[model samples]
Target: MNVMEIRNTLGASVLCAVMFIGITALPATLAADDDAPARETATAEPPDPRLVSRGKRLYVFCRACHATEEVKGSKIGPNLAGILNRPAASLEDSLYSDALRQQDFVWDEEKLDTWLLRPATLVPGTSMAFVGLPQEANRTAIIAYLKTL
Candidate 1:
């Protein structure tokens, strides 16, 4: 091949290699990293089955006060059937503390994590009696289960 032909072939080969690497590595780069902070996003994809299963088990702790089913009605806490993305203290029937009512924030995964870590810290004077889930894994599992509700 002539010099120009060799150069053209080499350039095309390099381009193909770069494209292949990007395509193959893209998913890996996007894969969930456990250490990364959790984010709440509306997604068409189904929740992770393993995470959901673990979360369901962890949710037993929350079941005493929070009812996930609307038909069950509000227990000690408001009906949490659709709590994710909901604004704080939006439930009219469920009496909320002034601390929670005065605030203006949506319940997203990150906020929920912080809340689960320590409700008192998140909202002082709030009525939630349970101390908090100290373990990050437990909190994550419980949050995952709550999302499914």
Candidate 2:
């Protein structure tokens, strides 16, 4: 092969190696950055069946306005398949209240807990109509179920 061709091949190989290393090391690098938002695991260990079952039952209240799966798409609320660690009101298509869209935050467990306890309390003008889950246990179960979705 010509020297120019060899040099180009070597440069391409080096770029690929750097990209691979960067991609593989991303999680560790992100973990060490205190300012970075923590990444949520999508392949977490299976949630307890009992907890999921209870949550599914409790989710009836949510089902009226929300759809969990994407194919079912957004109803009154947005699809929640990957809600955990997601930014508030980030979905491009779904309509959100000014109160919710104006705020900035990721939806972690604590936030979800508070949101479950009281939607309006979390985002005063959120369009969601469900009053709130007064019981912590019920909220926990529902969160667990949501993680599976």
Candidate 3:
């Protein structure tokens, strides 16, 4: 092929390569920018019906392991009835990890919030297999629903 023809072909190939790269990266760049407004922002909304209902919906996963029963014990996890204000791992029948059972604190809102964010982090060696609710809104919803139990 002639040098002029080769140069024109090479220029076209480079242009296509650059355009392809830009097109591929555009969506990811825009996605990051779209989330910028919400980054590090707290929810202005208080615990409302939407949050409670959302939490109730989220609680379906917990139902497999726990029950709302006060006296009847759960096989997978402890009964969560009246969990708020109750001491951690207070249920005598269930097997609680030493880290959790030794904690000398009640299941208050603040504590529950932290725990639900990451159960293993809150109590290392705890038996809970849940990774955690990373989303603040989801955690808030779950905690609100827990209050109803």
Identify the runs in model 3 with alpha carbons over 4 angstroms from their true place.
1-47
User: Model 2 segments beyond 4 Å from truth?
Assistant: 1-45
Clashing pairs in 1: none
User: 46-107, model 2: which lDDT tens digit per residue?
Assistant: 68999999999999988978899878878888889899889999887798889899989999
lDDT of each: 0.88, 0.88, 0.87
| Per-residue lDDT of candidate 3, residues 1-149 (tens digit) | 99999999999999999999999999999999989779737544345778789999999878889988776676688999889799999888888888888899999999989888989887888999987888988888888888877
Per-model TM-score, in order, reads: 0.70, 0.68, 0.65
Model 3 residue 113 CA deviation (Å) reads 1.2
State the lDDT at 131 in candidate 2: 83
Residue pairs in steric clash, candidate 2? Answer: none
Backbone clash pairs for candidate 3 read none
